[model samples]
Target: MGRSRSRPVRLVASDIDGTLLGDDAAAARFRSTWEALAEGERPLLIYNSARSSEDILSLVDANLLPAPDYVIGGVGTMMTEGRMRTRMEAFIEELGPALDPAAIAAIIGSIEGAILQVAADQNPHKASWHLHDAEQERIHDIAARLRSAGLDVKLIYSSRRDIDILPRTGGKGSALAWICRELAVDLDEVVVAGDTGNDLEMFEMPLVRGVVVANALAELCRVVAQDRRHYLARASHADGVIEGLRHLGVVR
Candidate 1:
C-alpha cells in the first residue's frame, strides 16, 4: 500500500468527466457538497481533464462547477491561469515542439477503424481518435506498428472507443506531479479521484493516492483495483468522490 501522508490533507485534484460530472444528479450533488464544506476547511481544488481551457471556462460560466483553482487541460498537454489567452499561449510554449498533428492524422487516417475527433479535442501533446473497430487485438497491432516506426507516443483507450495518443512525457499523473512541484504542494497531502482509462495514469504514481469511483469503466478497475494507494469506492460519480474523501478522512 502507498504510505499515508504524515501531514493533514490540504488539496483535492480530480478529473472532470465520468469522475466528477457523470450525470445531472451527480453533478448537482457534488456542487452542493462543495458548497457545504467549511470555508476554513476548504481544500484547494484543481481540475484535470481532457477538455480545452475554453470549454472548461464555458462550464464555469454555465455554473456547472465552481471556478477551479487551476486547470490541467488537453489530457495534460495544456495548463492555463483562468481563461486568459496569454496563459494558453504560455502553455503551448512550455510544451515545446511535438509530433505534428497532420502526421498523426495521416497515420490514423490510414487505419480504417480509426476516426479523428474534433479539432478542439486535439493538442500538441495529444492526438485524439475514436475507433470504429473497437477490437482490442486490432488496436494493439496498430499501437505496435506505431512503436516500431519510432513515433514514441503512448496510446490510451477508454470506454471501448475513445483513443488518445499522448506524448511520452504527457499524462494526468505526470501533470499532477508537475503541478505539485509548481505549487509547492506536498504529494502526500493531495487526493485525486477519477473514473476511467485516462485516469489510470493518476493511480500509478506512489505520490497520488487515487480514488476510483464506482461508475468507473470495468477495464480500469480490472487493471488498477489491486494497486497500492488506489481506493475503489461503491458510490458512483460525485457521491463517490465524497465517499473517497471520507475514506481518506480529508473531508467530513
Candidate 2:
C-alpha cells in the first residue's frame, strides 16, 4: 500500500553506499532538507549500512554524512546509537550466538572463486567475502554447505561481487524493525531507503514505506516495482532519497 499522508514520519532508515554517498551535490541537498526540518517535526535518523559502526562514525565525524540517532552497521549484525556509541544490548542478545568464522572459512575455502574480505569487513557475527565471476548455483551451493554444517546463517550477495554471511536473525530489516519496536514507532511511520540487492530486505518489510533510488540495482528495482508501498525516485543517490521523502510526504 502507498504511504498515508496522514501519518507523520517518525524515522528514516537508509543504506549508505549508492543511497547516500554517491553524489556530493545530492548529499548536500539531503543534509539541507534534513536540517531544515523543525525540531519537533524532525524524525529520528538511522544510517543502516554494511560498514562497521566505527566506519560509519568516521564518516559522521568527517562531516561526509550527517550525524545519526542510530546506526545499524555490519549489515545488521551491529547496532549503536548516537555519538557516544551506546550499544543496543537487546538487539545483540537476540542475535543468539556469534557465527563461527572458522567453520565458515572451512566451508567456503573449498570454493575456488570465493575470496575472504579484509579483517575490517568481518565481525563476530559476520563473515564477508568476494565472489569472482561465480554463478548463482555456486552461491547457492555455498549457502547449502553452511546450513548442512548446522550453521544458522543468512547469505547476502550484493553489487554482484560482495558476500556477507550473517546470523539467521540479523539483517537490515530485522535490525530496523527491532529499533522501531524498542522506540515504539509504528512501522507505517518509518521510511527505509536503499539502492542494491543487500538493501532488499528492508524494502520487503510489510507496512514500512520504501525508497528505491533511481540508481538502484536491477534486482532491487524489480522487487520494488511489484510493491505498492515503495516509491521509485526519479533522481539518483541522496537526491533520490529526498525526492522519495517528498513523494511520501515526509518532506515538503
lDDT of 2 by residue, 1-252 (tens): 344564778999999999998999899888888888886778999999999998998988887888899999999999998767998888999888998999999988778888999999999889999986566787898889999999889998888888899999999998998999999999988899999989998988878888999999887998788887888988999999999898887788
lDDT of 1: 0.78
Lowest lDDT block of 10, candidate 1: 82-91
Q: What is the Cα root-mean-square deviation between model 2 and the actual structure? A: 1.8
Residue-wise C-alpha lDDT for candidate 1, range 1-252, written one tens digit per residue: 333454666778889888888777878877777878886888778788888867876787888876677788878787766534235455455555786677677677788877889988886688899985377888787788778777878787877888888877677887777878777888878888888778788777676677899989887898888776778888898889878877777666
RMSD of model 1, in Å? 2.9
Index of the highest-lDDT prediction = 2
Candidate 2 similarity to native, TM-score: 0.95
TM-score of 1: 0.88
Provide the overall lDDT of each model, using Cα atoms, as 2-decimal numbers: 0.78, 0.89
